[model samples]
Target chain A: MTPIKGLVLAAHGSRLKASNEEVTEFTQVLASSLIDQYKHIVPAFLELAKPSIEDSIDAAVAAGCTDITVVPYFLAAGRHVREDVPEIIEERQKAHPHVTIQATPHLGVSEALKQAVIHLL
Target chain B: MTPIKGLVLAAHGSRLKASNEEVTEFTQVLASSLIDQYKHIVPAFLELAKPSIEDSIDAAVAAGCTDITVVPYFLAAGRHVREDVPEIIEERQKAHPHVTIQATPHLGVSEALKQAVIHLL
Candidate 1:
């Protein structure tokens, strides 16, 4: 049987609940847009918010996702992006060796961000 | 004489100097793209970094800019975006009525952001 593919949008969570909600809401929007490609697109946080990255990965694995991608929804590479997130994902990968767990580059590094800024101008 | 136009990219500053530098570097890239329209494209921080919004506006005015736009480089409409930035800009506007100072919608609200995410996938 073909395995299910899942995605997790990992964000630098905010103290403001509303701020975190914005990330969750955007994750839903992404899910809607890529409905065919991913069975689940979950929102997780690194700190100061609920559903940490580990929990989200566990949930996805429990839901029968054999392949999962964690995309950092951050603008720049900080300590969290450079050290924390990758370390967590590496540990999780060891625990779920059968599952293909990968972390992509953060959103800020994308060329599309430059285009977005240009579009605003 | 034609009035000079300036732009300020206001970011939620980070303690990590490298992270702050990323925003500054990106502002330079934006400046390059908008060379014809804006004479100066400066980068400022809400906090935890140098060159506050007010200072950027002051510097731009000193540089002979009659019109300036402050673009919030944030991903969400949080307190910093909704309250702090506008309040700062409002006070600055009052102080510099001769200059047309305006704050544009943040980068996150742009449709280009969604397109950027799509490109990532």
Candidate 2:
């Protein structure tokens, strides 16, 4: 049987409700685009929000995902991205050793984002 | 005589020094790319960082820029983008009546950013 893949869009949650909602909505949009590649796509928050990284990972595992990818949707590689999110991922990965859970670089470091900023101007 | 244009990349300032540096460095890269269009391109903070938006605008005016654009380098349109940043821009525009100052939408709302996120996957 083919391994079921899962994806997580990890974001730095905001105190503002709308801000968190925007990430959730965007994740839905992203999930639709990646329907073929991922059986499950979830939006997880670092702080001040629901469905945290650990919870998201566990849920993906429960959903029978054999492989998972976490992408940080942040503009900078701050402590949250560098330390907090990674720590959560590390813990979750150990808890579910059978599942291949890995994190990609945060969004800010992407060269594509730099080009996008120029295009916005 | 042509009006000298200035661009301000306004970001949500971080408490982490390295986080702030990343934004400042990105602004420099952006400035290099926009050299032909803008006489001055500066990075400014909303809070928790140095070189506040008001100061950046004042410096741009002092540097002989008659027109300025402030682009909020933020992932979400939170209180900072919707209210705080705009309030500062409004106050600064009135303070410098000779200078035309305006703000663009925050980075998150861009369709290109959505595409970029997909590309990263």
Candidate 3:
């Protein structure tokens, strides 16, 4: 069986401590829920938050994972989604050529999201 | 017709300046697209960004809007969603009891969001 390695939840970290914790807690909950399939689930941040994308990717590689999937925990396809993330991915790919990297998309407007918004309304 | 009023996009403005501008730009684009229905679409920030929610709401009321819809530019249901926003809404409601206020939900993981994410992948 192809070794299913790591799932990395990447977020834009906030300088506010509580905000950082919020994203970390969310990632933890998500990781726990996906424990069955993913042997390892980690949280990384673009800034402010700890264990940044670079560190998380390196950690995953160091932990004997040849494959990593990066999931961006963002709402829109802004500069971070359009530029920063891809640049990071390219850098990581070059640094760890043997490791396969897959970057998921930003969480954009969708039915479920719209419904969630409606529920809040 | 009841004076169709304003739509406010509330975001957590970043100190990084560019981040704040990005959200502002996105809100402007959305507003431009929604001009037919909403006479005014304004961008507000919880912090850092200019034109706070309080200010935007006040502007809407000043502009003779009896109803205002606040859409949170957030990705998940965190403390901001569960706590901070409700307090702001309550305060707004009390201040402008005659003005109808609607607080929409955070853009949680949904089909559309998921699809958008997938598209990035």
Local distance difference test, each candidate:
0.86, 0.86, 0.73
Question: What tier of docking accuracy does candidate 2 attain?
Answer: medium
Q: Which pairs of residues collide in model 2?
A: none
Tens-place lDDT per residue, model 1, A10-107, is: 98887888888888888888887888999988999999898999999989999999999999777777777788899999999999999999988776
TM-score against truth, every candidate: 0.88, 0.91, 0.66
Worst 10 residues of 3 chain A by lDDT: A112-121
For lDDT, the strongest prediction is: 2
The interface RMSD for candidate 3 is 5.3
Per-residue CA lDDT of model 3 for A19-114, tens digit only, reads 667666666666655677666778788876689899999998888777898987776555677788888989999999998888875555444443
lDDT of 1 by residue, B29-84 (tens): 77777989999889999998899988999999999999999998887777888899
Candidate 3 residue pairs in clash (backbone atoms < 3 Å): A105-B117, A110-B112
Query: lDDT score of model 2?
Result: 0.86
DockQ value of candidate 3: 0.26
* lDDT for B73 (candidate 3): 77
